[model samples]
Target: MRSQFLIGSRAPSIEMLTWICGKPVFALQRGTIYIVALFSTICPHCPKTIADLGQLHEKYGDTGVVAFGVAAMERAATADEAGARVDTWLNKELPNPTISIAFEHTGEMNKLWWVASGSYGVPTIFIVDRDNSIAYIGYPDTEDPALLERVLTKVMDGSWDNSAEAKKAHEKWLQGALVRRANVALSIKDFKTALSTIEELNEAIPDNPQFREAHIKVLLEMMHDFEAGWIVLAGLARDAIEKNDGDWLLAAMQQLFGSPYDYSCLPSAERFSMGKVLSERILTLCPQQDGISRAISYGAVARYFYESGEINRAVDSIEHALELVEGESLPDGEKQNYLAPLVQALAEYKGSEIPREFAEDPQNRS
Candidate 1:
């Protein structure tokens, strides 16, 4: 049931359209370990992943570890142009990074490494053991801070080879493949295939919140099959309320106002009605938490208030999010990054000019 290119399987040879840094590695040396990160120049999450990979290279280079970054998914005029963009981005974002860096122009790396391995999303990682078998394949980051180091250490000591750790990594990445299949199906407007994949995944991996939110998005937003979407979503809402589960309700709110779920075909009344219940439940579950983490929920709260014909409450929620972001020690640019959505929401809620303070004009800043 596992793909041929998997954990315990021989890693595909390193290939790059262009080498951006360090010694060019075309083949995997039998004695060396590797950390191959597939990232994108435009992917906001990639910078951190690349930085982490660089850190690992610094930590493990003397241990015969080969860490390299292959930049993929860059949209430029040509391979040369994309390579140039990656080169510039590295210089600015990661000057003198400790790892080898390459630019993927031909899309071969993507097909062979990412799509072939069944890994989902940007910042995919493949850690090759000394035997050249893929010891780990999945996201570079998780709740576990020392996950990479722990796994790398195991692989180096040969304890992870043919071990249970390898088996779990193999299973998890293969599960990601199901999500990848769903994404591919959705991309081509193959809603039927997408829905089937979602159902199969839900049965197999029910706790994946992103997939759960996405499943509802596909039904209610993409397929416009309100009948099917509500059948599951309404049941989910009732369960969340019955359990007084804030996390469940937060995931449910994505259906109403999440960026990915447009809800164009779903009646506004139905959308607003659901938003009101889910958002209120979230606040009720965690009322005393007014921190920035709680500020994220305010967008959905604002959506509910706006749709329920309480413009003032909606505006207040957006303003609170903006104020919280502003209070952070982040640079003005980063603050704008967080404030952009809230400001846009405020503009919608007010049904009038955006307050002069949050507008993009530099002169408006205090």
Candidate 2:
């Protein structure tokens, strides 16, 4: 049997000491549906997930859904150290069910539930049924209220079916809103608004996965104040990482590459490090994936290397992608749209080796 680590597996119980409301909450029972968000106090996405969980807690507390946060402590001080971190942050945010801060049971819980042990990134969400069965598994965007609600509704309803018409409607609503809002924001050149809408869409529907890619595409095509927007995008990408959300992270990578802003212009090496991390994850997650997604990711890799001034790497990524893509056969502009960058990047690095039309000529400068 495939490992029952996903939905429908009996959840492993956690009996540990935690503090909530200035009182010790000991041996607290996991609710009918237990949301064990595997995260670390320092994980960039953890704080935002916690904050959103707080909001969800308020909305669903009476619905037999319990949101428990589990952070892996890798330091010497351990649980005490991690708990203090949670406490400091929790105090600043709205109060929700006791955020169970633990240090000791990290490995044990992972082994029991069959989750990959250690490396608890932020924004990881797990909604287990009251029967202690893992109902819904995947890193959800806690920031987006709609996405969070949709995920919780499925868990509370005791049905793990993500194919329900309701879920489709919810997704449609989110995507339509994001794409439409982005277009409107683009027309007006309100980059901040465009970025804000995209950010909200990402947070609301991190799992929709493609939504972030679309967001990045539009942002790159329209937005000008990329510096501030890029910072927000970084945090949002970090949030997707803790959730172990491969698709959203991939989308984030594509966006950075499509971005008009130059990563080399930034003084810090942080952007490059993040780009590398995201690229590795994408390769690990998406193998042989096709269509616009493959094109977008490839274009992104090319742009990432190009922005970092790795001209050779950029050229190679684009060239390989061109080989993979049957662009001449594609009728829609979408395929060609993504290929343009790679062609230009290749021209920049390899010069006349690329075709005349595809090469970076006077008109190719954007």
TM per candidate comes to 0.53, 0.42
- Candidate 2 — which pairs collide? 32-129, 32-130, 122-242, 144-203, 144-204
Candidate 1 stretches greater than 4 Å from native: 1-171, 242-247, 257-276, 285-290, 355-366
lDDT of every model, 2 decimals:
0.76, 0.59
User: In candidate 2, what are the lDDT values of residues 34-60, reduced to their tens digit?
Assistant: 566766555676666766676776677
Q: Give the Cα error of residue 17 in candidate 2, in Å.
A: 62
Could you report the Cα RMSD, in angstroms, for every candidate shown? Answer: 9.1, 18.0
Write down the lDDT that model 2 would get.
0.59
